[model samples]
Target: MSDPIPSADPLDDLRALIRGAPGPDRGAVAAARARDAELTKPAGSLGRLEEIVEWLAAWQGRTPPAIHHPLVAVFAANHGVAERGVSAYPASVTKQMVANFAAGGAAINQICIAEDISLKVFELALDVPTPDITVADAFDRTGFVATVAFGMEAISGGIDLLCLGEMGIANTTVAAAVHYALYGGSAEDWVGRGTGVDDEGLARKRAAVEAAVARLDGERDGLEVLRHVGGREIAAMAGAILAARHQRIPVIVDGYVTTAAAAALHAIDPHAIDHCLFSHLSVEPGHRRVLERLGVKPLLDLGLRLGEGTGAALAAGIVKSAVRIHAGMATFSSAGVSERGVH
Candidate 1:
């Protein structure tokens, strides 16, 4: 064979890392499944919980998959789209919410405290709101790379599980625009009442998304789409997810904003998703469709529209419980219980 040609894209290294990331360990999965079959319970009695064990074992390359040092990172930023009167909350709310997060006044903070999960909020693109995507690129190429880099850095260290969340005014608008760009469709299908936008404000959000979609470059799925319609925090979360996979740290994904980032990365490279778990479904209209496109089901559907990683923190406990059940439950032989066929 001839020598392979070298790639020149700035994102090539990251892309290579993502694409090269390993999936769940098949040997571990086989062992876990065989063990499950021999357990006291009937075949597939635990449903997705059983499957979660398989997934965790496969990724950790051990039986009863492990969830260690759960970390939640909420990327906070401001979207220029918020300035267009699309969101019920003002752009200043993004900053105010960031303060609230730091002060432990936000929902995510209380959830993290109760769960004993480490939570950090990266104030990305706070002072510098992303440019209005309808009229110009939200961020230049370097800026996009830098934003992702900031997230990757924040998530560094040996984290067993990482939960991603976002806090940005009008980010849903940006996410809707990105969704439309990646998976072509009516903006109406992706648009929703972000932060309780009224009918008039929702209409304005749709109009903005439609215009942004109309102007997308010939390049439909790369940095162009991001700079055109992605929020800084969205980009940051995407980067963090990708890096978590690269580092063998699985991610627990939160609501719409975090899901939107995951979707964008999924569009880029689906393999990255092997390192992630869908935490919950949000009330946001676009969330279900995003999960559908991802071909995964969330662990919870709690009518959550609040972001800031609250969903991820709640789901973290469930993940640990799954592993605990897998590791702790007595086997058929150990418990002296009759096997399914015998009983």
Candidate 2:
């Protein structure tokens, strides 16, 4: 068999990103759990959320989960299918929303600020052909690889964790198409009322996806399918996830669109899933299907549909709590308590 596709090494780039902080420490997690058990609460009283925090603590290799340099990366793009009226909002909304994120006016902005997380934005052109999109599209494969390689590498440095958000009008349509191509599901299974599409708009969105799938029939390669129907932001997010895994940094994924992108990435490299955490269940029809296929239970289920990493950003708190409990809760032996259930 031919050699497997090679991904860049992220450790060196991470060293530069973090200025040399060590990766997570297993020992710190043990110490933190001991402290947590001593806090006078029943063992696991905090429930699964506490367990999540404990895991985060272990992931961070720190007793207490820290957000000193938390990072939220938002990728924006426009889809050609939006030209067919698949989304309730116009394609222009993609660029406009990117502006909203830059100005700190979107839901993700508020949540990230509230959580004290640093946010960065990247533009990848999957379909839209505007001049700005041209500049964003200038990166060739090597450049694209390096950009993701460096971005993931840098974000992993001293950065406690990473969250991914996406903005692209009609992006859900692109996501659905990618989902269909990768998973062989009907467009009905993957399409949803993106950005509040009305019944007529929803029908059009589904048709567009179906049309895209029919057009690409017989082509099963993930990258080829993405090129045929995927959006730039979707591709960039995939690259970001790959980079995160390379750096051993955990990534919290947002809603349907991001999940679709992730599905495509997983098709390319199954190992990428190891570093991902599903943030929430989107009310969007396709979101749950993709999550189910991924075999990941999201941390939250608030009927959320907004993209831009809002769900993941909100879920970060739950992850922090889990890490806290994992690192802080006391083990049975550490608490000086005798086992009561033993024969």
Candidate 3:
């Protein structure tokens, strides 16, 4: 399954980079933390901001890191399970929302505009959806490779912070299935009311996820689990996270669906987690379990369940401000202020 060249196999390239990806620069992290202590504000006064700055420094391999150009990629794809009434909205909404995102009409578009961050929607096409996870592999190998490459190409140069988002109907079901596959659990433990599914719909969603989890018999440590339960967009987000870490760009993971991709990516390479910042802990029941397993804390918790990278865009500003403060603020020595506890 490992192809040496990109032409032979695309997924191989991703796997290759992820396997070889280096750990974050510890020297940069130490220097950034040292700088944070010298800031005019009290040590650790900025709370998460201080941690964010250090994260940016280590990921970018530089101290005083700055979020020069923030970019959010909203990977959109359809799920075959959606045809089974898991989501409240029709599957057509996935394609329609992609147009809305393109036309600058969605909430994420407006958020990107307000924050001055670029936004792009990667619609994996509505005509061809991933197979139902309950029966067959959710994604084709070739298409999965293409989606990952597409995500990598979307990320060009001059990108400081990478925010990952998704737009797919019934994706929470897909996410829950992957979650259950990754970590053994009951359907009730992983399922959530995605898109505000009614009681009966939620029950159906859990049943579908449970069935999907039961169908897995492949190698647990390989990509078989993801291929069986992950959608193209989810695969692409995993690729993007891998690509971001391969490039040493710090990535901000959105909500449950995005975190699911992060989870899948982490399964492949635990080292990649060092570059990821969980934007928020989603209300989705399974998200907390994933976050806990990863041992990473979410930056914000505004009860955000909307999945158009809204949580990511909202967190992007805070991350940027952290860098700006770390880079632009004067030290107490420069400000001519007496050091704390100086007799």
Candidate 4:
């Protein structure tokens, strides 16, 4: 039979996915909690570690959560805004870094190796940078929808956990602009010294963010705001977050830029990122603000701002430890340890 014709509305499928997103598995959560109580440890002594295990169980839909095939996916793109000198690094660094990733020379490569996780770098047309948001919308509807589709396709290949990150010169500026559009604040509230820009560069970056948000004229839709200000990598990361929700894959989001990308989804549906874990608090100033806005606490605070999934990969090790502790520790009965308050 011939394949069914695609829907006329480009965003119809995405809308349905968001509306039909799944909730946590109560049975699995209960099972995890029960097992935790039986473990030879004081209740709540494990702290966030215990909470992490429960989150995994709820999202993975299993009694005890596991991370057998954790994958870190990094999307790299170039931005037209880089031409405005918002970042200290040249756009060529994005391409060079992609090559470095391929050569196993980047920090992410080493982290994945250390954590025994798989790393995949996706280059989103490094040659074709998205339009400078300060001057115009970054993407038309069709292009934005297509980039989101690419992100959805990224979730395939039987991965159990997903870590989302991005690489692009001036992407921090792009992310700041998106945040400015979504959450009403001054450009300084959203912009940061990406790649360690100088005072002049920081001022230019702030101006770019202000102009980008002003050009939008207070648009309300979350996805529309993203389309106006987001680049290919940010759009793809947002798409991957949504796709992971549908596929039941828990996500670990990297620092500032990734959080900004996720903010778009959060705006679309407050609970859209329920399955996600913020990996770290970036040194980037706006990261803290965005995290506060989302009301989600991150797993680490190491003053890390380097993108390329480095922070997420590091946090993945902690997650793996939580799973191991949950699954490997002996129960009170098995360990013959007397329960508290026993006669």
Q: Decide which is better by lDDT, 1 or 3.
A: 3
TM-score of each: 0.93, 0.78, 0.93, 0.96
The lDDT values for all models are: 0.83, 0.69, 0.84, 0.91
**Cα lDDT, model 4, residue 309:** 91
Question: Number of the top candidate by lDDT?
Answer: 4
Task: Please provide, for model 3 over 149-267, each residue's C-alpha lDDT reduced to its tens digit, 9 standing for 90 to 100.
Answer: 77777777779889999999999999998888888768888899989999999999999998887888534543567778888888888878877876889999999999888887677
lDDT of 4 by residue, 1-343 (tens): 9965667876666766776799999999999999999998889988999999999998999988989999999999999999998999999999999999999999999999999999999999999999888898899989999999899898799999999878999999998888888888799998889899999999999988988899889995678888999899998998999889888999999998898778988887899999999999999888999999999999999999899999999999999999999999999999998878332
Candidate 4 local lDDT, residue 79: 95
RMSD of each: 2.5, 6.3, 2.7, 2.1
The residue ranges of model 4 lying beyond 4 angstroms of the native Cα positions read 1-8, 341-343
Question: What lDDT score goes with residue 200 in model 3?
Answer: 94
Q: Model 2, which residues run further than 4 Å from truth? A: 1-40, 54-66, 125-157, 325-343
> Model 4, residue 58: displacement in angstroms?
0.9
RMSD of 1: 2.5
Any idea what lDDT model 2 has? 0.69
lDDT of 1 by residue, 67-146 (tens): 76888998888988788899998899888988988888999889988988898888875888988887888887778888
What order do you get sorting by lDDT, best first? 4, 3, 1, 2
The window of 10 residues in a row where model 4 has the poorest summed lDDT is: 10-19
